[model samples]
Target: MGALLNQTCYLCSNTKNSIVFVENGIDIVRCSNCGHVFSTYEQEEHYEGYWDDDSSYDLGWWDHAHREIYQDFIKRFLTAPSGKILDVGCGLGFLLSEFKIKNPVGKPRVTKYPKKRFNLPGIKTD
Candidate 1:
């Protein structure tokens, strides 16, 4: 178990004003400083080798219903898709895949801080 970094809220950086929303099963803490909710506590050794494989994520992210929802967001927010689309924390590349289908010419750029787990390079968006 990796030591859970639960000292302060990521947004407001306040340690004194936290309330544990769940105390028994898993400590889900909500920071009063910024009203940000976070899950507290993780295994001290966070890295469980091989278990974090991309295929493992694929199974969980198989809910294709999100494609419609993401399409709705694209229709509402993005304009023409001329520039590179930046997808922050692009988990499993579902949204990016949709974007690629919508914009064939524009490049899709994905980013994840610290380390990126997976990259859906050359996605067959069509």
Candidate 2:
């Protein structure tokens, strides 16, 4: 278990909070006032962890695991037939690829690797 964060609740501005659980070395907290679940770890504004690595990173399991979730998300929210989609940190562009397949009229753009954006394995930007 991790220590309680001194910061106030982001939603209701209440200072009272309790630790929900710790996952992957970060403490997940819940606000006592608004019931909002958030992480206690302070993340960098522009944290370039794995996204900055130029080496070939294969996340085949991630694509396979998130396919159904991405499909459901596109069906639920991305209902627009034509629009601009700006995806930041699109690891392997799985979601964008799914979006493109469902809605081919939209201009889907990834912000991670500009030079290699169109070179993702399963993504086809036509």
- Scored against the true structure, residue 3 in model 2 reaches a CA lDDT of 53
Tens-place lDDT per residue, model 2, 1-126, is 765444566446677778888887677888888897877775444454545556587667888899999888777776787644646343666676665433222113333443254444433332
Instruction: After the best TM-score superposition of candidate 1, give how far the Cα of residue 70 lies from its true spot, in angstroms.
Output: 3.3
User: Clashes in model 2: which pairs?
Assistant: none
Predicted model with the maximum TM-score: 1
The C-alpha lDDT values of all candidates are 0.51, 0.59
- Per-residue alpha-carbon lDDT of candidate 1 for residues 80-116, written as tens digits (9 for 90 to 100): 7563565535265567656543322111222221123
